[model samples]
Target: MSKRVLDVGNCGPDFSSIKAFLTKNFDCTLDQAHGMEDSLAALREGNFDLVLINRKLDRDYSDGIEILREIKADAVLKDIPVMLITNHAEHQDAAMELGAKRGFGKLEFGNPETLEKLQPILG
Candidate 1:
């Protein structure tokens, strides 16, 4: 079975890396929704094992935190792992408490240790 990964990104290189990583590690298929509305629409129609949300959106839209809350509130999507990937360090603890499996900063995005850190949760 193919696991699905969703990226709520603003057309960045991060999406490419994430797609590559999941393809290499989990043989997963990736689909991305660019912003708040797109992400929500994608959630309604697709099934994902993991989700990556950028903390800040490109335009004036709902931030990752609000998206996190919406995902958790949905009975069907609540169990799927949602990760907040950001440059901000301050949101880590709050994200963990808000039902994200983990919060990863941009600096660590491609680090060797990053995959190791995610192994326990994503493996």
Candidate 2:
């Protein structure tokens, strides 16, 4: 069966790149949300195997950490695995501290290590 992933806060090109990469490597479907509200609503309404949140939202350039916090704080959504898409180690560390899995950077999107990092969740 195909896994479902929720991709939050990415712009058009970024989202397209993520969708293409995921579809190519795994049996999965990708859905996107541009900000906090839509992301939360989509999580509540759909069943997802993983969530990829951008470090900075494309729509308003708002912090995506807030969205991550909200998900971790919500009882219903807390268990779903989340990964923050960023290139900075500090940000990645922060997300993991809040219960997210290790995420990959957009700069390393097609790297072999990125795919390996995603294996446990999407494999």
TM-score for all models, in order of appearance: 0.82, 0.98
* Lowest lDDT block of 10, candidate 2: 102-111
- lDDT tens digits by residue: candidate 1, 1-123: 667778886455767876776677765788987776788788888877788887876456557788888888889878888888786767866778889876677677567777776665456
Clashes of each: 0, 0
| Cα lDDT over the full model 1 | 0.76
What's the lDDT for all of these models?
0.76, 0.95
Could you tell me which residue pairs clash in candidate 2? none
User: Which residue pairs does candidate 1 place in steric collision?
Assistant: none
lDDT, model 1, position 59: 52
**Candidate 2 per-residue C-alpha lDDT over 1-22 given as tens digits, one digit per residue, 9 for 90 to 100:** 8999999999999999999999
Off by over 4 Å in 2: none
